[model samples]
Target: MITNDVLRRVRYALQLNDKKMLEIFASVDNAIDENYLHSIMEKEGEENFVFCRDSLLSLFLDGLINEKRGKKEGSSPVILPAKAILSNNDILRKLRIALNFKEDDMLNALASAEFPVSKSELSALFRKRDHRNYKECGDQLLRNFLNGITERFRGTSGKDA
Candidate 1:
């Protein structure tokens, strides 16, 4: 899953405005202006569209966690290790943490998008990479999850449209 897509989906799912999006980024010490944010959100082929790097996406995910779950009382926010590549599993984990979602919530959300998933299958997606049971999440799963989130937050009738 592309970071830009993830960011855009999250923004739409949460109905966050430009100011709120900036605040979320700032919460994790990643200062980004509205113009930059908009550029990043733009369609890939659009003029001025900026490709969002993994570090920025990681920062945004961290910021999202802080925004939703509240920052730890005394400790500094944990910085994601700088990595050149980010996997779909990383994105799924960050989203789960940020939303405080339980296994049941994830199952329900996936099901809401008509993407049936068994408990064991869902658990496999969250397992450590070295674990034998770990399964790589595909783009389709993330896409469904995002669509499910949109339905959950915005309602099935497309009232938010």
Candidate 2:
């Protein structure tokens, strides 16, 4: 559960103004209105507004925005400081685990989709420093890789097992 302070903080971190926040929210499909977001921020707070940390994460993942806060110095202006925890490795790890695949298997799947990744490369991808590299793979490549994996693994499950 995020507090109002946290919500306000994230907005500040994004360097977003009220109008820009409204625009960003509006851009998302089926996203709540400005008032709805405001009310949530007012009531439940930032945590409530963010149902999927993964989505908020994707914005960072795509390099579309930064998620750091500014710190004030002694009687000086705010200094932008980078927050060091904005990677989507957890999401990737979870996806790989759900598919019941090892790093090599995922690499193979990615390769099958023309991603041509190696186990070592895959491991690197799971690290924070490789975010820029992963972003370069673009959403289309990631989507294709996911689609291929799910398609290949679709019928390998048994219900009530």
Candidate 3:
């Protein structure tokens, strides 16, 4: 999924206002004003739409974790791999951390959206690439996960999910 879409969906799922969104960004020391935030939130192909880079998304995810779970004392923020391309796996991992979800909660969230996921299958999604058990997360899985998030937090899934 596009970073903008992820940001928009997450914002809706969490019922965040612009001010809160700004604060979330600020939590990670990335100060974005309302105009920049709006541009990033704009639809693809729209004039003034700013493509969200992987680093920015990474910062936002870190900020989200801090916003929801509180910042850890004496811990430094995680830095994204330099020049790394963000993937669905990265997004999923970040969301999991931000929500502080355990294995069962993730499974339940997916089930809540009628996208039942087996425990082992879900585990594979979080595995390290060279672990032999690792499986790359597909766009469909991320979409379903986000839909499940919507159901879990917003009381409803997307109409077409």
Candidate 4:
């Protein structure tokens, strides 16, 4: 999935305005320019559509964590990996943290999207790559999860992210 699209969907789901979006960027010390923000939000093939990097997406997620769940006091800042890969699993995990979803909440979110799964399957998504039970989250799964959460928070799933 496109990182820009993920950011857009998250924005819609969270009802983030331009100023708030900028603030999210600033949350990670990445205060983006207004024009750049618009470009990032622009749809693909649209004029001035800017590609959103995985690192930026990760930063946004971190900022989101700070936005939704208050930043922990006295906690050391995390050093982002050198080459951030915003995989579906990573996206889901970050979202789970940002939205403060518990096990049942995560399940319910997926279920709300009509994409039910066993607890073990959900756990596998967060497992290390070397883990035997590790499962790679599919695009469909992430899409449905995002839609479901949109419905849960925004009162409607709206369109695809």
CA RMSD for every model? 2.2, 14.8, 1.7, 1.6
Local error of candidate 2 at 79, Å?
28
Candidate 3 lDDT, tens digit per residue, 13-86?
Answer: 88889999999888887889999999998989999999988888888898999988899998766667788888
Native-referenced Cα lDDT, model 3: 0.87
Question: What's the TM for model 4?
Answer: 0.92
Clashes of each: 0, 0, 0, 0
TM-score for each predicted model, relative to the true structure: 0.92, 0.36, 0.93, 0.92
CA lDDT of each candidate? Answer: 0.85, 0.44, 0.87, 0.88
Per-residue CA lDDT of candidate 2, range 1-161, in tens? 22233334334433456676655444432245666556545544334453333344333222222112222233322222354332235445544543456767777666655667666656665666546555333445455455445445442211111
Compute the lDDT of residue 157 as modeled in candidate 2. 16
Which residue pairs show backbone clashes in model 3?
A: none
lDDT tens digits, residue span 21-83, model 1: 999889877889989999999877999899998888888888888889888777555565666
Please provide, for model 4 over 22-58, each residue's C-alpha lDDT reduced to its tens digit, 9 standing for 90 to 100.
9878877788999999999999999999999888898
Whose lDDT is greatest here? 4
Worst 10 residues of 2 by lDDT: 61-70
